[model samples]
Target: MTTDGPPARRLMRWRNAVWLAAAVLFLLNFVQRGIDLFSIILTAIVVALGFAVEHVETQTRRPFKNYLRVALASFALGLVLVAMPLLMGAGIWIGLILWAGLSGAALFWCTYYERTEPR
Candidate 1:
């Protein structure tokens, strides 16, 4: 009387195996194609621009020119970061490391300036 129940369980197992196989195939495709840089560059630019806006709000009390100056500087820096790999023939990992180093240096400089400047 329970034969139909066993068939349902068997079908469920096969369905799970098929789903797992499809998922594995999808993952392998991505591993083969490698990561892309365009999205990364766009993300970096947005973040840098956001930081520039924040910096202008907090650090610069001057007119709109100062805001433009800070924002433009940050944008230029981000552009250079995004172009480093193409310009230097560096791999993605090296470009990321270079960007990190430059960002760290900029952060340090800002920290020092904030401490030393009159509030």
Candidate 2:
């Protein structure tokens, strides 16, 4: 036999839904407020993925320095590009788009180079 929930059970369902919605909204606001930090994180993750193409773990113990340098330089370049009058004047959205596109291109180039020209 199928069982239908009682009134209290139905309320429990609504309670869970409310909690989930609250959590989602909170996360959305948090991300919106820290977009710059998120952008940097995205760049770092892409750089790390590029390095993964060559099995970064197999490299020398000192390779971390090189990887860190590349990630930092990429992040700095992204910030500079976003801050330029050309992009900034376009609007914040445009600047963010440009930053993402540049970061992706840089990461892809890194991956391609590592794949074809092993050290």
Candidate 3:
């Protein structure tokens, strides 16, 4: 049990490192591209990866309803983000902050509601 603890800790640390690296890379890509099409692509890829991670962690097959909900949420969020510059015009920064907050909230909701039992 003692030996297993160290191995488990090491694996956890490695997993964290991988996630951190992915986040940093995504950030760099967004910053370099100035949050246009590239940002959308990156966000989609990240979201897909997140879904995959959730699938693995929960050990359950994807539910159609959940997938539909996620897709609708993502589309709505993307629309808001795309319209932000035009809607706010003078306060683009505020729109960006709102977009970030919305994304965070959506991710939290998904994580919290994700089913853990096999389906």
lDDT of each candidate versus the true structure? 0.60, 0.60, 0.65
Q: How many backbone clashes does candidate 3 have?
A: 0
Error of 2 at 85 (Å): 8.1
Candidate 2 local lDDT, residue 102: 74
Off by over 4 Å in 1: 1-75, 83-90
Cα-based TM-score, every candidate: 0.34, 0.36, 0.38
Clashing pairs in 1: none
lDDT of 3 by residue, 7-106 (tens): 6687777778877887888789877877887468758866676666545544544565565456556556655675645644654666667777877787
Candidate 2 matches the true fold with a TM-score of: 0.36
Give the candidate number with the greatest TM-score.
3
> What pairs collide in candidate 2?
none
Could you tell me how far off, in angstroms, the CA of residue 68 lies in candidate 3 after the best superposition? 19
Q: Count the backbone clashes (under 3 Å) in each candidate.
A: 0, 0, 0
- Pairing residues by index, what is the TM-score of model 3? 0.38
